[model samples]
Target: MADSNDSQPGAPVPCAACRGTGQVISNLGGSPSQVPCPWCEGSGTQIPGHDAQAARRAAAA
Candidate 1:
């Protein structure tokens, strides 16, 4: 059998911070909230936090 959790092409991976839940606790509402992703700039993708090279590549895309 194939190992589970293997990445399928075109499928969005889970968020590491929200544990794929897509929402975090909010102080004002006392409810969940969608936090801007630090990696992909809230695009929900793992983006490099390196130099301007990574940022430029992302912008170009």
Candidate 2:
């Protein structure tokens, strides 16, 4: 296994549901079709410690 420092931690590598391509592939022969990454939600970057209360005041609000 690789170290956390070597690579970003808690970051969504790729939306398994949508794949790293960030699109809902369908009808292979279709002209064009694509969507955002469901896992990362198209952000491509996952915020660390999202579960934690980084902003408790906002959360409480």
How do the residues 1-61 of candidate 2 rate in per-residue lDDT, one tens digit apiece? 7665666655456445555555564354676656554345565544344432434345468
CA error at residue 42 for candidate 2, angstroms = 2.8
Model 1 Cα displacement at 14 (Å)? 0.5
Q: Estimate, for each residue in 1-61, the C-alpha lDDT of model 1 and write its tens digit.
A: 8687787776676656555554444454686666554344455444334243565477669
Model 2: per-residue Cα lDDT at residue 22:
51
Among the numbered candidates, top lDDT falls to 1
Please report, in order, the local distance difference test score of every candidate based on alpha carbons.
0.54, 0.50
Instruction: Give TM-scores for every candidate, taking all chains together and pairing residue i with residue i.
Output: 0.30, 0.31
Worst 10 residues of 1 by lDDT: 43-52
Clashes of 2: 1
